[model samples]
Target chain A: MISEDYDRIDATLRSTLRDVLGLSETRAAALDADTPLFGAMPELDSMAVAGLLTEIEERLGILIEDDEIDGEMLESYGALVRFVATKTRR
Target chain B: MLRFGPDQGPLVAVALPLFEDANRVRGFAVAICRALAARGVATVLPDLPGQGESLVPLENCGILDIADGFDCATKEAWNANRRLYGVALRSGALLDKLALLDGRWHFAPQDGPSVLRDLKRIKQASQPHIRLSDADWYFDLQAPADHPDPPVEIAGNLISTALLTDLSVYAPWTPADGGPVRIVRLDSDPAPADRHVPGTALWRRAEPGNDVTLARLLADDIADWIATCER
Candidate 1:
């Protein structure tokens, strides 16, 4: 289970990727904190990406911007967590 | 042939729209499945013949065939569960209707005068795009004779007669159990009156295109819904 604190974002990310997407932990963890999700994960596509974004938004109570889709934030699980942390901080 | 996955709970079988293979399943269907799965509600998404990887020919596909296929898929795909929900998108009306309350959760959009706007755009576009299915029209609820024209910009400002005729008959499919049959509008905004209706979950955000806001909102909703349905 993920902790309520920001550190739990890792657990949240892992659980979502593994349980919801049925991805193996080895593959899921292979993602670096700064990797582009779409290009990195064969399972991630436009639709899946959209689904992930929505799930994240509703669960985290955050809003995403259209211009934010870049190679930086999506680079890795850590990257996404950092991005979420930045947004939550703001 | 349908795929089976050791159905246990009420089978939640989702029907993909025409020309939309498993790829489109990534968006809404996957969200719904994740939502249900979190609740321990097992879900199934089967690629109809001719579409997706099913290896069927396009010409051989029809609305009835899709619905029947959904039925066969549901029975064999899922183990006998007390409830079965069918979630269909833009063009999956017939299957949605045929699968009516087969004890399954059905997520669809409401058909009203507003849809004409979407159809008109499809008709007028210069490029050849996927034709909006008549299924949207089939679900339209008849507007009253006194019903005013829906705001011009509701869909895309090109409402047509066929589109009008279509919206008049649509009633969001209500199940026998009254358990929430979430009707979400894809690709359009809800009318002002629609905002106040209970059980009408509305989303007006434009496509997020991998943006942070889009991602955040989607993830939050998926997580919340997942949390909600799993329990």
Candidate 2:
């Protein structure tokens, strides 16, 4: 994706995480490329993952297959954004 | 039923989203009702069968039963000589089809298959080792042939297999289906809607939450839409 599109996806991912997890604005804004998610974030338990992925798909206008989800894609903030960016590009 | 605003005017009955989303958005729905009351639009948030304060068990209730409960709520208002309008959030859209209302307003309405998909995902998330097929996820492969199919538990809700089957095909009422319908969606969603508003998806929150600003905005929208319908 282009730089502008990438930035938009990154912002969307941040907001999606905040909304789905009910995080504060400051916490959401603090997320960055290196910020670990999934197991690292206390709010992102297994059940929360389901809502998070569905919300991401709805907001990004993309479909996320069950198998496409794995620890690697959600390992960090940047990884999730890149995964979504790839899906949008497709 | 939780009643708000005036008692003798047109009534706007509200339906919370089904299942877990209903819990997540209950506070938000109440916020909207209170905001609508401030706008002088009466609203009622009812406990549908097998949901909220209702005594009925969810495992024993089907889509039609819940829909009938909603219909009954509107019928009570109709009997009292008041005009009725429906305001539903998320999967709540699927429950208002049988209600007699002058107009229907839906916020981020979810279709049946999509609701089922979310439930399935939640169920799968709770049990990573079990591969749940779409055909018979609630059934046990090793159980006796004559054994009764048991209810499946998803994220703490004990839901019946029959209800899941009904949700596979149930859909919200639309303008094309013979009614005045207004659909409002969050700006992030790309789905077709009569209007798009700036807001996060409150129902997506893992815990129950409220968005007072979005509630006020939607209340204003619903009030304005109801006025136009009355005209």
Q: Which candidate is the best by DockQ?
A: 2
> Comparing to the true complex, what docking class would candidate 2 get?
medium
Second chain TM-score per prediction? Answer: 0.51, 0.97
Over all chains combined, what TM-score does candidate 1 have?
Answer: 0.41
CA deviation > 4 Å runs, candidate 2: none
User: What TM-score fits each model?
Assistant: 0.41, 0.94
C-alpha lDDT values of all predictions: 0.48, 0.89
Residue ranges of candidate 1 with Cα displaced over 4 Å:
A1-90, B1-7, B20-25, B77-82, B100-120, B127-172, B175-188, B191-231
Q: Model 2: per-residue lDDT, tens digit, A37-82? A: 9889999998888888888888888888777888899999989988
